[model samples]
Target: MRAVEDYANDDDAAPLDMLAALFEARGWPCSVRGHEVSGEVRGSWAKYQVKGIWRADDRVLQILCLPEVRVPDDKLGAAYELLGTINEQLWLGHFDIWSNGGVLLYRNATMLGDDGTLGLSQAQALVEIAVEECDRFYPAFQFVLWGGKSPADALEAAMVDPAGEA
Candidate 1:
């Protein structure tokens, strides 16, 4: 197994980079967008947005995954459910989801609430579900590091591309 530090240092490409490569391999044009969030109420957060344009019909697909912070333990289960829902309804389908503190909710380009929060186990479970479901529906989905790097690391990394520009 590769240590986190080792993988982080490897030139294997950041998560977004890897995603871009995956899309390209599948013959899709992809664009990555990165963002950072910090404030008194939420403290800080990061977001990574990946959008893919299909060459066949010029259709677009997007996936917005982020890391969150200070999530209360009590909310973990609900958060997991939310994550599963996003994977099944939005992410696995045509819509793109982007969020840091909360999982990005989308209604055809309209920003919705970011409602993902859970304990480690629940979070991992949610990730597992995403991995399986995404593979089943969208095999192109890949995970670099799930559960964010120690929560905070996950949040920061999710929102901001290690490559700098989305």
Candidate 2:
């Protein structure tokens, strides 16, 4: 078997380059720096900042979406509990809290495997999934953080889908 580095692209364009292009095409503001591309995505709940980082050595692309929700020190335990509940409901990626900062975010990673190439649609999907998950669960974080709702209750409240338009 060959090493992962053997599959790295010989050109200057990296996986994040694809993300930058996709973000541009979607009209989401973004900046590219080295192997990373950071952008702002608008969700139903709120706007989020997404970062796409490319690792050539592992042939992996990691997407991090911050919902801009900060958990208070007093709500840390409940926040963690909520994270567990939220993550359990997710099938693709997982929700996480930055321990030091108490910031909430959704994270997912895709391995490019031997080819080490990331398609435009794949890049679009990664960002869409991260943003969608964060938006879908943002209210739960709010319920637990400020509304004084338990993790289970908050999840239940936020997970309900509304029927036909009013």
Candidate 3:
């Protein structure tokens, strides 16, 4: 087995740099600090705070997209249930609520393999997926937390796709 120091010492910030660049190219406000890149993206329902972290040891790039909605104390259980329902419809990442603050977020990750090189397209896809999913499900979260709808009902109400712009 490799020494702990060997595993901990080698960390590359390039992946996060690429993510920051991607955000800048798209005109999204992003800040890069060490191994993390964080910024905000506007979705249909709300503006989301998006953060990207590079875990060099695991060769993983993780992204978190946090919506503006907060789950109240009484709605925690329903919110959790809605997460399960929403996650099932997701093809890429899943939604989760923070245990400490009851704040909702979408989490997703991609492995860069042994080479540890994250392509621009891959980086773009990761952020795009997070933003898209958050936009798609933000209303469902509202339906559960504010509308007092069941998970099933919230999903149904939020997923209605109308045919064209009005």
Report the C-alpha lDDT of model 1 over 1-166, residue by residue, as the tens digit.
2222343344342333434444444344445445211111111223222232212122222232222222344444444444453445454333223334433322221111232111223222332333333333221111112332332333334344356565
Candidate 2 residue lDDT tens string, 1-166: 2222322333223577677767777789989888888999899989999999888999988999998988889999999998887788889989988987888889998888587777655776888899889888899899988899999999999989999999
Q: Quote the positional error of residue 105 for candidate 2 in Å.
A: 0.8
After superposition, the stretches of candidate 2 with alpha carbons farther than 4 Å from their true spots are: 1-13
Superior by lDDT: candidate 2 or candidate 3: 2
Best by lDDT: 2
The true-structure Cα RMSD of candidate 1 reads: 18.7
Best by TM-score: 2
Q: Mark the regions of model 3 whose C-alpha exceeds 4 Å error after superposition.
A: 1-13
Model 1 segments beyond 4 Å from truth?
A: 1-11, 35-166
Kindly list the per-residue Cα lDDT of model 3 for residues 1-166, writing each as its tens digit: 2222232344332577667767777788888887788999888778999999889999888899999777899998888888887888888878898887888899998888797766666777888889899988888888888887898899998899998889
Q: How large is the C-alpha RMSD of every model relative to the true structure?
A: 18.7, 6.1, 7.4
